[model samples]
Target: MNKWRNLAILTAGVTMLAACTNNPYTGESEAGKSGIYGGIGAVTGAVIGAATSSKKDRGKGALIGAAVGGAAGGGYGYYVDKQEAQLRQRLVGTGVQVQRNGDQLTLIMPGNITFATNSSDISSSFYPTLNSLVTVFKEFDKSGINIVGHTDSTGSLALNQNLSNARAQSVASYLSSNGVAGNRISAYGAGPNQPIASNATEQGRAQNRRVEITLQQMQ
Candidate 1:
């Protein structure tokens, strides 16, 4: 299934590139086509990390994708299924939680394992685990990834936002340096605005202080 999806992407990209060889590119100029393909690339990106996202957020991601008319041709779900399976297999016993929704997958790394108290620095203990994950990502290059930072309400709103942003940047930077293309991965900080637990309790706060990385299916 991966081979098929990879082939499809390669074929489309090659065809688009070959179009430049034709004479009289007035109606099909490189500039126009490049813009369209770039839009499709955006769709490819948004499709990642949106499956487990909130409905509103997922909708926004889809809008970014649909506006460019980018799609993975057909059988996109199957391609994603294979990739998700591979990811789950690789992440076994890594202290990372893998969640799936439709053809998208999210990697939830709790703050306990991902970072220190009020720090954005990724722990050295987490390096080996991330290396394993990056090995899979390098193989499955078609998917787009989004890294989101979340925090509990223990700090000021401004501080929480900054912390969240920095944490997200840390993860995204790590992934980029490890092999994920910079263009296909994005980072966003939700701060305290999008908490999954009550801020009144230690347990809830622990759960809220986490990072989520979503991978969209290839298109």
Candidate 2:
């Protein structure tokens, strides 16, 4: 009986590993990570269930555990996929670049479109774009919003950091005022430390001086 149990556990481990490797859901992307996690959860749950159940009912317990674990692990990935689709549809031609990395979604608002030169105040013309974002954020309350302010390397480090911080706060405050829960939002300033482009040219500087809002799943 012990030998059979050991064989069953080994079989489950091998099967899950294989499934994860070949699974369409698994990959280096966020969606793929979700699949790998789901596979791992399934394997872990199956092992636990089988070990805890009577010898005669081990298989049934394992199956139930696998089902539950897989569902739990994949739920967030599904949620992110839907949210991404909605954001892409809403942000069309709005000058907000929607980026997906792993399980997070980032909306990159160019400095030119969101604010005036060296100012933290949001431009009046960007209100509608922000309002659209607020709508989706409210609908998907399960995610946390991280507003990060960034700047070019033209300014002194202190000045750049302060400006970035203020800008991040401005955006965070706007989102909060527009009805996104304050508790679900955080603001930070990255200054010129994390530039997406070389700040040697005007165009590169323009890209660097921007605001990024990233959506992350809440536990």
The root-mean-square deviation over C-alpha atoms between each candidate and the true structure, in angstroms, is 17.5, 4.2
Give me candidate 1's TM-score against the actual structure. Answer: 0.65
Q: Residues 1-219, candidate 1: write the lDDT tens digits.
A: 553354346445633543332212134443333334544554454455344456556655444444333433224544555676687787888879987665578999998998999999999999988888788888888889889999999969999999999999999899899878888889989998887889999999999999999998544
- Could you say which candidate leads in TM-score? 2
lDDT winner among the candidates?
2
Error of 2 at 49 (Å): 6.6
For model 2, name the residue pairs that clash.
27-32, 30-102
What overall lDDT, based on C-alpha atoms, would model 2 receive against the true structure? 0.83
Measured on C-alpha atoms, candidate 1 has an lDDT of 0.72
Residue ranges of candidate 1 with Cα displaced over 4 Å: 1-74
For residues 51-152, write the lDDT of model 2, one tens digit per residue: 788988887778777777766666676678778889988899998998888779999999999989989989999999999999999999999999999999
**Cα lDDT for residue 212, model 1?**
93
